[model samples]
Target: MNYAKEARDLDFAYKVRHALNESAENLPVATLDRLASARAIALSRKKQEAPAVALAFRGILAGNTGLSFQGPTSWLGKFGVVLPLLVLVMGLFGIYEYEQQQRINDLAEIDVAVLADELPPDAYLDTGFSAFLNKEEE
Candidate 1:
């Protein structure tokens, strides 16, 4: 991960490419023209097939053309980011509310059971009562 070494390597590669390009000019005129044509064709094909989302970024330089969203595309992009976070917060809130309701329902059921039984009210406070309720629930 040495950036200096990478920069030096890149510079060396560029020089090598320059030298090769210079040597390539010495090739036959027909060969050079064919090579240029092939390069142009390859670049055109690559550009046509490139994904839009991958290029949904600002230009490489200050004002070059790439994907720049406007109107609905811009709104959709912003909404795309916000929608998931909103859903997550709402989902968590719902789960917490559901849990609270369930706890309340369980307590209400216990209260009804204690009221409906024939046992004395004092027996409800006995330690065994809790265990008996657990066994009943199971």
Candidate 2:
């Protein structure tokens, strides 16, 4: 879509330039000379355009080049990058600890339930007891 639009714009520019050239050829010599002089003056007075430069970390890190990041705010910039990573590490550690605690609590609950039951603990180890419980479920 963009390519087609660009092609149309380029075609329109070429047609306009061709029309201008055709009309300019029919103009009087004096008028052509005045236009030429005006064009030359405009070109001569035009400021030299600065080269386009891309922003890069290499430029910032190196103190001598383009824009320097070595001033008072340099530590702040480093801290900005470090702070998020510190937070992520701490968050992950916290999540891990929370999961570990949940698993321990779940095991403790199961142990307490079994201990509180009226049946002898040895009955749980009997294969017949397990079969009887399965049958009871049916």
The numbered model that scores best in lDDT is 2
Question: Model 1: runs farther than 4 Å from truth?
Answer: 1-73, 127-138
Tens-place lDDT digits, model 2, residues 3-89: 999999999999999999999999999999999999999999999999999878443455443334543257666687788999999
Instruction: For each candidate in turn, give its C-alpha RMSD to the true structure in angstroms.
Output: 11.6, 6.9
lDDT of 2 at 29: 100
RMSD of 2: 6.9
lDDT of each structure? Answer: 0.81, 0.87
Give the number of the best model, judged by TM-score.
2
Taking the tens digit of each residue's C-alpha lDDT, what string does model 1 give over 12-97? 99999999989997899999899999999988877456555655435333544335552324655568778899999999999999
Which pairs clash in model 2? none
Candidate 2 has a TM-score of 0.51
* Positional deviation of residue 61's Cα in model 1 after best superposition, in angstroms: 13
